[model samples]
Target: MKLKSLFVVAFVVLAPATAAKAFPIVRIDAGQLIGRTLDGVDSFKGVPYAGSAAGPMRWRPPQAVRPWRLPRDAGEVGAMCVQPYSPGDPGVGPLPMSEDCLNLNVWTPSERTEPLPVMVWIHGGGYNNGSGTARLYDGANLSRRGVVLVTLNYRLGRLGFFDHPALAAERPEGEPAGNYGLMDMIAALEWVRDNIAAFGGDPEQVTIFGESAGGVAVTQLMVSPRARGLFSKAIVESGMGRQRGVTLAEAEGETLRSTRARGVAWAQDAGVAQTAAALRAAPAAKLLTPAPSIYGGDLVINDGIIVGHDVVTAFEAGEQAPVPLVIGTNSAEFWWIKPGDDTPYGRFDDDMTPEQIDALAQGFGGREGYDAHVISDVIFNEPARHLARMHAKAGLPTFLYRFDVVSEGSTEPHEGATHASERPYVFDNLYSVRWDYERDQRVAKLMAGYWTEFAKFGDPNGEGRLRWPDLRGEVDQLLEFTSDGPVIRAVPNPERLDLVERLYQKAVREGAVAPPAGEVGTPPQRP
Candidate 1:
């Protein structure tokens, strides 16, 4: 993904003061916070979950937030993590940026009987951009569904994922090096577990969900031992499942860029010395280049400790969390996202004959670019099925989805649902995009229902909703959010995805570019 295309998420927080309660206070592990209440939702925006990852703390694990005595005003959105481009390009104006960005936003119903389920949102930017405070992630509607909603900001770009030899050598043994963004997420979840009760949220029922990059993070959290037991349910929207990862200490064979190599290159380009101190001293502004070296395949570095292995490989070994899971892709998932060598097309870029390319392209006969379909299949849908299958094979409750609901609002929306398009529907924030078509509104309500209900009851299905069969209940079954409503159906574009699957297996068996060895064996807590 150019990622600007993917960060294309999943809210604007603007709201009227009509019938609004002025001040609501909540106490957490950090301190007391004063939030504004409007439209039956109490919102605590820019609440710190952990201390800043700025200055010397850069590239390190997130530390506990320093307790505050005074009530902090969490009404304003927090600073976005250091990254390239303002979120949503020109639509949502400039966003705040900072390294002390380990913050989150919360929305809860003003009235609830028992503790409500908690939903922690990890925004998508292909791991390099996007803020949890994006205009599309507003939790007001979802929170009104009797759940506490949380969205967060984590380090992005080199600030988040870079691994350097000097830093690695200097760091203490057993401390996982790369994947700081993932660490930030774990910290946020931990904060939820330790503090959400004060906000009428039951941390035990936490469901972690995201779109695009955020969806990918959901899978990463599943495979990570550090994140074990932190979340009970997981939802991955357009987060391709089959994408592999590079080892913490190893460079990507396809790109000849070890994360450490990328780290070194990043420092050189920023005109800084290669020492750990110099790297740390480098200006944060110069290091904001987002990575797309290989979307899906390039993120969530497989550190031997923090991250055990790639998502597909780990799940194949039954390493993912054995909890209720929801993973799916859109009908035109890659219409905007570009392809890279790490993708199937990129993997076959050099050796694929015209006959081979034609064989793959034959299945996608239409005005829609076959190139986009192939990339979408291999990078999005194919992996989604494989993951759904594996997760279901464990006899765990797993729900898969194919979102193909395109709004007739305007030509401004993609021709198909496309990547990140389903986000508004999930948050029921179609108003953010001026999409008020009845079909669009209906789909948004259905999506928000499925999502919040899943967070509540571990199942998306509820009264009046169509029965979304489990993946194990039927061959390739999934709950598709469409122009109608949630419908139980077979995986979309199966033949294309199957072909891509075969090609992917062939690539692995042929060992053209093998997955990096990450001291793979087994761990005490699954992956």
Candidate 2:
């Protein structure tokens, strides 16, 4: 996939007006930016909040930006969204990408005057490659622990989940044709609910966090009713709520018109012309080559306009987003599981059979812990304990955690705490990763003080830590963290999350999972 070499460098220079009066401006609603204050925070960098998903706004949805009448300057980090560059792709070495990239990045707390509480961040790759300018998502030490950190940039691979019936008959009539990257994360949470109070933040005290595919986009923006009040709280770390997708009638036959008819037969096998303006003026490295494995998977689409269901039937009908949640996972998550490739003991190539890996390792208790418990209980500890037991059975305030710490210079069978190895200890960003610097800054100050104390008060139990309870009755209990600290256990494998919740209700009673284009009713009116 050709296009890599960009990484520009000189991130906005022109200073000296007394070093631009020591940087820090702010005016938002689209004008004066400036930023950069350092240690006591402030920062800013690459601000655009939307507009320019590139040429005919790629797959639509985002929009707003265009304002700037001078001031500008936000020093660095804005290109990244034109995917495919591997070497474990996240920050450093190869990113400064393009296809316009819809920006965002803040940090705040330069001596705050009030407002405060904000969080945001969504970076995990897998929705196809990451970058909220990834240097372990530097939100200056989580905005020096006061709150107001944000970090954005959406739209990725296939330019953020492509779909096409001629691009859904050229969109416009009720827009939404395949998760335009979850509507660019609800337009960056409606630009953090209308400009995070001119940078003091507190846009209704937001929270939304992320980890793996930004923790499956904070459980798909907590069951997205166009992302409800745009965040009151949510965390999600390894992410998954029984991840489902494919629907515009199962992506119009075996998915997105069979990947846009195999990218128009590989753009007429490279002679480049089966039009849509010749596959939008080709050469995005000849339209990102590597296709067939039945056109690789996930272009996230329950598409009833920005996912109106299927987050486990909108959290088993309690319809989600009643905020306050922290979710978890990662105790050897993916510990490099092998034996079979498509995990969960299912698809293992080279014509399998050792009696089919001993009948899929005798229902997962053998082939020596069947690829680390079916790649850590079917992709992330039973979909984060079934979305924290459906947000503690809808009575909200759920907490749950399990990190299990690793990095003592990890290197064994890929050591423990595998997948995302606890993202630089939940963004206190362990001094940009080499590891064990005083035990990763004391587990990044106890996981950024239980994530800014659950974004200030939605409860992570304050003053002199350790309590963290909440996942209600029948002894569910959670919080584990480890490396010799935060403990309070109990709920770890509940019979393998009740056998992967009966294998996701037998793949939703055999239709191999589908029900949720907003449960077959009204959803079409946001052109």
Residues 314-342, model 2: lDDT tens digits: 88888888989888887876565454444
Clashes of each: 6, 2
TM-score against native, each model:
0.89, 0.36
Model 2 global lDDT (CA atoms, 0 to 1): 0.71
Error of 2 at 369 (Å): 36
- For each candidate, C-alpha RMSD in Å? 7.6, 19.0
lDDT of 1 by residue, 130-218 (tens): 79887788899999999999999988877887777789889897887778888999999999999999999998999999887788889
The stretch of ten residues in a row with the least summed lDDT in candidate 1 is 518-527
